[model samples]
Target: MKRPIILLMGTMIFGILLSVLISVLFYGKNEVSNSIDAGTKKIVQKEDKDPYEKVDKTSPTISVYNSSTNKIEEMDIETFLYGVLSAEMSSDFSEEALKAQAVAARTYIIYKKENNMTKGHKGADICTDSNHCQAYFSYNELKKNKGEDWIKESYPKIKKAVDDTKGHILTYDEKAILPLYFSTSSGKTENCEEVFSSQYPYLKSVSSPYEEQSPRYYTETKISKYKFVNALNKSYSNISLSVDNLINQINVLERTNAGSVKTIQIGDKKLSGRNIRTLFGLNSSNFDIGFENDTVVFKVKGYGHGVGMSQWGAEGMAQKNYKYYDILCHYYTGIEIKDIY
Candidate 1:
């Protein structure tokens, strides 16, 4: 009877141990499976994610008035900027300068479009005429003008400039600004009110010391005393400008903070410097007059309106290792570089 009782207790103990071992094996398998499943899920989640999910990759379309062809053409913003960058700045400029130009051009277009400033273009958002709006040259036109070798070397650079900047634009107070830019400045940018009728906070006067290397920075235009007197007389009916007394007749009345001529006393009339620049086809309004016998030598500094970002100045900043955004911000005061889809 004692042997049977011991055998029964041993059988029960062995059964209990077997049940515990089976339960432990099943639990261990489940944990390993769960670990593998979690890792797989993590891999799948990472694979499904987009690297540029937050980035704005949209390139909008716009209408540009082709002044050469006298027609309105539709193009994507990037393609349009390719033409603008090619026509606006030298292809030999540094990559950062080119990128800065791309953003400025983009901002100008958006500002015009948002403000409904298309009446000048006959219902177009902008025009290819450099006189009225930004200049744009198509690929074929560029190939014709710049030669195939230049196209091969420079087209890619221009396209990269546009692509790298994508949809960047200059803004103030969360709104797009005019983003006016020019070939060079007279050691400083002009105040908006001095050049245009309106004043802009971002268009205030700022130092631009890098434009000295520009070919148009200091230029001399020699006009015959007879031509000078006749030109002023044609505009001012009440003035008398004798060739011998031309120096006395023409005097710079006032200069802006940027060293550009603000007002000039020509004969009996007080004219804005911009008026004289237009009349004489001068390179810029920052000019000093000197007499060389019968010639009226107009020594001018800089080019364009001298209102905003100087292209040569931008290049100068690029040479100093400044990034594109830095160049833009330096020229356009109190402005933010924003991305528009």
Candidate 2:
């Protein structure tokens, strides 16, 4: 009986050991699985921590003030550029000239945005008024202006020019430049100091012999001698006008380096040529006065302020096979083309 009892005790001990071994194996497998799951969860949490890790850096949007509607509109930069290009430059220009205009327009706005110079406009980065900011023509307006077929043909070309030179801007010394462009020039572009209060090294005088292609290169407007004197007196209240004083006394007192009249002596008062141009509705400051019969003839040369890039000159250069960058560099003077994106 004692031997049978001892054998029974040994069998019970073996059963207990087998049960403990099974529990240990099961626990070890479950621990390995839990560790793998925890590691995967940690990796996922890490990835989710940075929300902007895969955000797109390009295609930024801007806020514009629609002067016509008197409302603020938000749109993508590229879309805004389409309107600007359409209104600012004619689609008939060469692709390279259009591209150069695109870069210049982009640089101008970016510079304005960077400087926070919105001219007191509320809740907007820029405006649609071309005189104030940059000119903008909506797709519908462009269709109306050019017709459906012309829009279909020309819009793609304009889009190509804009897209091919995407994010390109002019930079002087690694900073954005305030690129001022105009319709045409006399034989040369004027220095910044000559036109505006501030002087810019890049805005120095440069010969633009190619601008003769512009329709406004040579224009003449005739006004009666009495009307001319009255208009001058209206602008400059100090000026005393009469037929005898106006005959030989009215002459250009000073001229800019580019040959645009800088100052004019009318009767006893001396006025800026720009003032005279504005008073008489002249095309440009470059003008010569003559008395023909009963009319005072004013022969004007070029158009606009003639302070920077000449659009007609740009088109002429493009016709001569100059690339967009080449045209920009020639006009801007010691500048670099940079991709902001």
Whose lDDT is greatest here? 1
Compared with the true structure, the alpha-carbon lDDT of candidate 2 equals 0.80
Clashing pairs for predicted structure model 2, backbone only = none
**Model 2 ranges off by over 4 Å:** 1-57
Query: How would you encode candidate 1's per-residue C-alpha lDDT over 1-341 as one tens digit per residue?
Result: 99999999999999999999998876644412211121102101111111222257778889988999999989998999999999999999999899999989999999999999997798989999998998889999999999999999989999999888888888999999999888988778888898899999898777776788899989999999899889888888787667776777888989998888889988778998889899999999999889899998989999988888899988987776666876777778788877777
lDDT tens digits, residues 1-341, model 2? 99999999999999999999999876643412211121112101111121112223486788899998899999888788988998899999998799989989888878888888877457688889887888998898989988999788999988888887777888888889989999988878888898889998778777775778899999999999888878877766888877664677787889987888999888889888898888788889989998887789999999999887889988977776666776777777777888876
Candidates in order have lDDT scores of 0.84, 0.80
The lowest-lDDT stretch of 10 consecutive residues in candidate 2 is 39-48
